[model samples]
Target chain A: MFKKVLVANRGEIAVRIIRACRDLGLKTAAVFSEADRQSLHAALADEGVCLAGFKPADTYLNMDKILRAARETGAQAIHPGYGYLAENEKFAARCREEGFVFIGPSPENIRLAGNKLMAREMAAAAGVPVIPGSARGVVSRDEALAIAAETGYPVMIKASAGGGGRGMRICSGPEELKEEFSIARAEAAAAFGNDTLYIERYLQNPRHIEFQILGDSSGRVVHLGDRECSVQRRYQKLLEEAPSPALDGVLREKMGAAALKVAQSMNYFNAGTVEFILDEKKNFYFMEINSRIQVEHPVTEMVTGIDLVKEQIRLSAGECLDYDFSSVPGRGWAIECRINAEDPENSFLPSPGTVERYRPPGGFGVRLDTHVYQGYSIPPYYDSLLAKLIAWGPDRKSAISVMSRALREFVIEPVKTTIPLHRRMLADKSFADGDYDTGFVRKFIPVDEDED
Target chain B: MAESPKRLEIRAPIAGVFYRRPSPEDPPYVEVGDTVKKKQVLCLLETMKVFQKIKSPADGKVVEIVARNEDPVADGGLLMVLETD
Candidate 1:
C-alpha cells in the first residue's frame, strides 16, 4: 500500500478515491482547478494543490502540474480517478518513468485501449465480436465512403482519441455523410485536439451494456458482471444497472468470456470496463473499452461486494486478487441513477448554482455518493454531475422499488434535477417491466406534451 | 404573465453558500444602500470548495439583500436587489 496517494482529478470521483485512501490509513492529496478551490474534494483531502485556471487544459488535465504536485507532496502513487488523465496513455507512461505508481491499468494496456481504432483491431484479433468497418482512422471522405459501402448504410463516425459522447456523428447516406464529416472532424479536433476519426456499423436501438473486468499484477483477470447503460441522452449515460436485464445465462457467459479475452489480450491490470452494444436480437458487438473505473462501477460493486477503488490500489501495488474468482460471481441486481446539477425539464442544460437544501437519500440498500452539502456552490467550469444514487436488491423489481423509494427521500432544493424524471421512469410500466431501450426516455418525456 | 420587479432580481453566479466577506475577519462585500460599480465584488459564493467573488454586472445601488451571509442559494435564485439610476 502507498504511504501517500495523490488524486489527480476533481469532483465526486476524487472525493471517492480520497475517502478510500483515508480508510486505508494512506495520506491523500487533491489537485483542483482555480474554479474548484472550495469543492468538497478539496476540503476532504489532507491537502490540496491548485493545478491552474478553470479550463481543463490548465487544471486537472495539466500533466506537468499534476506530476509536480505528487512529487512535492511526496505521494507514492497517483490515482487519476475516471476522467481528466485517467485513460491517458502518455500520462501513465510518465508516471511509470518517474517511479510513481499509477493506479488503474498499466500504460501498455492503456496504449492499446485509449485509441478506439487500436482497441477494435485488438478485439477483432482476439476473436471478439467487434463491429465491422474501417480498420484505422478514415482520413479521406473516399475512405469513409468505401468503409460505409462495405459495412452497409447508417455508419457511425467516432473520435479515436476520446469518448463520453464528445465527438461522434451518425450518417444515413452519402449526402448526409459528406455534410456531417466536416462538422464531426471539427468537433473532434476541438474536443480532443486529435481529429482522428473511424467508421463503424451503427447498430440501431442497441442496448449499451458493459462488462466490468478486474485484473491483478500476476496477469490474472476476471469479469465481475455486465452493466446496462442503455438509458442515455446524446451518448451521456443517464442510468446504469448491473446484471443487465437483457442478459440470459448463455449470453451472460458469452459476453463475460469475451470481456476477459479483451483484458487478457492487452494484459490489462487493475480496473477497466469493456463495453458492448447488444442489438435487438441479443447479438452483441464490441464497442470501446474504458481504461478506468467508470461512474457506473458502484452497480457492479453492489452485487459483487467488491470495493473497486481499493482493488485498483492493491493491484497497482503488486497484490493478487484475494478471493476465489469462480466463487465470486455477482449476485442480486443493482441500479445507479446519476443526479446531475443539470435540469431534465430544461433540456438538461447545465444548472450551476447554490444548493439551498442538501438532503440525501437513506435507508437500507440505498447508497448515496456525493461531495456536496447544502451550501455548496455548483461550479460552471466542470462536469454537472452532483451525486450518484445506487440501490441493490435480490431482483430487478426490488431494485427498482428501492431506487424509487430512495429518489423520493432525496432532496436538493432550489436547483432543478432529474429526480422527477427518475420518479416518472420508475413508475412507467415499460421501464418497470424492463422493456425500455435507449429511446425510452425520449419517447416517454416528449417535449411538446403539456404536463397536466 | 406580466413581469414584476421581483422577476428582475440579481442572482448568484454559481451554486454555494453566500459569504458576506472575503474571509471571516473581513467586512461584508456590500450592504443595502451602498453604491456599486460594474465589476465590483459583491460577495463571495463558496461552492465545492472554491471561493468565487461574485461581481456586480451593472452600476447600481444595493437596494435589498435577499440572501444573507452563510445562507445556501440555488442556481438562478435571487441573491440581491439592485436599483439602477
Candidate 2:
C-alpha cells in the first residue's frame, strides 16, 4: 500500500479520496487552487499544496505542478478523483514517468477508451453489442444521407471525439439531417478540434444503465453491478441508483458479463465504468467507458459494501482481487441525488456565493458527501456540485421514501440549489414508479415560465 | 493641467490569481505614475495554469494598484486604477 498519496483533484470527490486514504492508513496530500484555499478537501488532507490559480488548467489539470507537489510531499502515488486530469492519458503516463503510481487504469487503456470511434470498434471486436451505426466517419453529405437512410431516419450525428453530450445531434427526418449535420460538424470542430463525425441509430427512451467493473493487474476482473443514471439534464446525470428497478437477475447477469468483456478487451485494470444504453425491449448497446472513479460511485458502494477507492489503490499496489465476483453480496436499493449550487428556477444558472447557513440531513439511511460548510464560498470557477445525498433502504420504494424525507431536511441558505427540483422529481408519479428515462428531467422541469 | 484626469479602473476579466510580473525574478509590470500604451501588458492573471496578459485598454498613467501580487481575485475585481489625460 502507498504510504502517502496525493489527490490531484478537488471538491467532494477529492475529499472522498482523502478519506479513503486515511481509512487505509495512508497519509494524503491535497492540491488546491487559489480560490479553494479554504476548501474542505485541503483542510482534511495531512498536507496541502496551493497550485496558485482558480482555473482548472492551472490547478487540478496542471500535471507538472501536481507531480511536483507529490514529489515534494513524498507521496508514493497520486489519485485523480475523476474529472480534470483523471481521464487524461498524458497525465497517467507522466505519473509513471515520474515514478509515482497512478491509482487508475493504464495510459493505453485510457487513450483507447477516450476515443469514441476506437472504443466502439474495440467493443464490437470483443463481441459486445454496440448500437448500429456507420463503420467510419461520415465524410460527404451523400454518404451521411445514405447512412441515415440505411440506419433508418432518427439517426444521431456525433463527434468522434465527443463526450458529455457535446457535438451531438439527433435528427428524425431527412430535412433536419443537412442542417444538423453541418451544425454538429461545426460544434465538434470548435469543442474537440476535430470535424470528424459519425452516425448511429438513435434509440429513443433508452434507460442509461452502466456497470461498475474492477480489475487487478493480474488480469482478473469482476463487476459490482449496474447503476440507473437516466435521470439527467442535458446529459449531466443528476441522480443515480443501484439495483436498477428495470433490471432483473437475468438481465443483470447479462449486462455484467458484457461489462467484463469490455474490460477484458483492453486488459483494463483498476476502477472503470462501462456504460450501456438499454432500450425498452431489454436490448443493451455499448455507449462508452469512463476510465476512472465516477461521481455516482457511492450508490454502488452503498449497495455492494465495497470501498471502490480503496480497491483502486490496492489494485494499483499490485494486490490481487480479494473478493469473488459471482457471489458478491448486495443489500437493498441505494439512491443518490447530486445537489448542485444552481438555480433551477433561473435556468439552472450557477449560484456561487457564501453559504450563509449549512445543515445536512442525517438519519439511519442517509449519507451526505460534501465539502462545504457555513461561510464557505463556492467559487464559480469549477463544478457547481454542492453535495451528494445518498439514501439506502431495504428496497427501492423505501429508498425513494427515505430520499424524499432526507432531501426535505437538507438545507443550504441564500444560494439557490437544485434541491427544489429534486423535491419535485421525487414527488412526480413517473419517477416514483421508475418509469422515467434519460429525457425525464427535461420534460419534468418545464422551460422557464417567464421566458419569451 | 486644464482638468483633472479621469480615473479608470482596470478590472480582472476572469477569476484567478493576480501577478504583477511575468515571472518571479522579473520586475513588476508597472508602478504608480508609469505611463502605458493601449494594449500594453499591464499585469498577468494566472488561471488554469495559463498566464493571460491583462493589457491596458487605453493610454494612461498608472495611478493606483488595488490587487497585490499573488492575490486571489474574482471576476471584475479591480486590479489597478489608471488616470487618462
Candidate 3:
C-alpha cells in the first residue's frame, strides 16, 4: 500500500481527497495553481506543489506538471478528484507507467466508457436496455417511417452531422414525418453538408437517474443505490438525492443489477457511475457510464455510509471489495445542493471576488464539503462551485426539511451564490413532492428574449 | 525645463491571470524601459484556458509593468505604463 497520495485537482474535491487520505493515515500532497495559493486544500495538505500558472491548461490540466509534482514529492499514488484530468485515459496510463497508483479505474476501462457510442454498444451487448433508435442513418422516408413505427410515435429525426439543436425535427405521426422527413434532409445538407439523418424515440420529461457502482481488481462489483438528478439548469445538475423518489425496491434491484452488468461488461473497477434516463412510464434506458468520480457522489455516500474516495484508493491498491452491499441497503435519504459563485438573477453569471463574510450551516444530519473561508479570494479561472451542502434524514420528506433549514442558516456575503435559487427550489411544491422531471428548472429561469 | 513625458496606462481587456510571456519558457513580450510598436502584444490574460492578448495601444517606451506575471488581474486592471514623446 502507498504511504503518500497526491491530489491532482483543486477546489472542494481536492480538499475532500486530502481529508480521506488523512483518515486512512496516508500522507497527503496537494498541487495548485498560482491563483489557488490561498486555497484551503493547499494549506491543509502535508505538502504542496505550485504548478506555476493560473489557467487550467498550464496548471491542473497539465499532466506533465502533475506527474512531476508526484515524482518530486515522492507520492506513491495520485488521486484525480473529478474534473480536470480525472477521466483522461492517457494521464492515467502515464501515472501507471511511472509506477504511481492512479486512484480510479484502469486506463482500458476509461477508454471503453469514454466513447459514448462504444459505451452504449457495450451496455446493449451486456443486455442493458438502451434508448431505442435507428442503428444507421435513414436513407429513405420509408425507412424512417418503419423505424418510427417500431419505436413508437413522437420520434426525433436528427442530422447525422449536426449538433446544437440544428437539423432536428420531432414528429408525432406519419403525416408529420412524411412532411418533415424530406425537409430535414435538405436542411441537413445545407447546414452540415450531410444529408444523413437518424431517428430515435423521444421521451418527454424524462427523469435523470444514475447508479453508483464499486468494483475491485478481482472483478467483483456491487451497486450502492440510485440518485435522482433531474433538477438541472442547462444540463448541469444543481441538486441531487439518493433513493430516487420514483423508484421502488423492485425497480431499484432491477436497475442495480443492470448497472452491475454494465460494469462487469467493461471489467470496470474502482468507483464509477452508470447513468440512465427514466421515462414517465418508469422505463429506464442506459445513457452513459461516467468513469470518474461525479460531482454528486456525496448523496450516495451519505445514504450508504461509505467513503467513496477512500474506497477508490483501496481498490486502486488492489484491495478486494470488502463492503457488504446487502447489509448496508442504502439507509435513509440524502440530498446535495451545489453552491456555485454565480448570481441567479443575473443569468447565473460568474461572481468571483473576495468572500467578505462566510457562515455555513451546521447541525445534525448536515455535511458541507468546501474550500472557501472568509476573506478567500475566488479565482476567475475555474468552475464557480464554491461548496456542496448535503443533508441526510430518515426519509425523503425529512431530508427536504433538513436541507431547507440548512439553506436558511448558511450565509456568504459580498459575492453572489446560487443559495437563493436552492432556497426557491426547496420550497417549490413540485420539487418537495418529487413530482418534477429534468424540465423543472427551466420554469424558474426567464427566457432570453434577445436570443434569435 | 523639458516637460515630463506623456504617460499612458495599458489596462487588461479581460479578467484572468496575467502573464508577461506567451509561455513560461519564452521571454517576456515587453519589459520596463523597452520600446514597443503599436499593436505589439504586451502580455496575455487567460481565463478558462482562453488567452486574450493585451496589446500596446501606441508606440512608446514601457515605463512600468503594473501587473506581475502569473497573478490574477481584473478587467481594466492596469498592466503597464508607456511614456511617449
Number of the predicted model whose lDDT against the real structure is largest = 2
RMSD of 2: 6.4
Docking quality category of candidate 2 according to DockQ thresholds: incorrect
Query: What does DockQ give for each predicted structure?
Result: 0.08, 0.07, 0.25
- Chain A TM-score of prediction number 2: 0.97
Candidate 1: tens digits of C-alpha lDDT, residues A1-452 = 77999999888899999988998889999998877888999999999888867667688888999999999999999999987899888999999999899998888888778788889989989999988889888998888888899999899899997666657788999888888888888878877778999998887878899998889988889888889999997688889998888888889989989999988988989999999998899888999889999998999899988889988988988899767335787788899999987668755655676789988988888998888888887776667788899998988999999999999999988777778888888888988878867887786455833222
Interface RMSD (Cα, Å) for model 1: 6.1
How well does each candidate superpose onto the true structure, as a TM-score? Answer: 0.82, 0.85, 0.80
Arrange candidates by TM-score, descending: 2, 1, 3
Between prediction 2 and prediction 3, which has the larger DockQ?
A: 3
Docking class of 1: incorrect
What local lDDT does model 3 show for residue A321?
A: 89
Instruction: Itemize residue pairs with steric clashes in candidate 3.
Output: none
Instruction: Tell how far residue A300 is off in model 2, in angstroms.
Output: 0.3
Q: Write the per-residue lDDT of candidate 3 for residues A140-200, one digit (tens) a residue.
A: 9999999999999999887765532356688999999999999999888876667888887
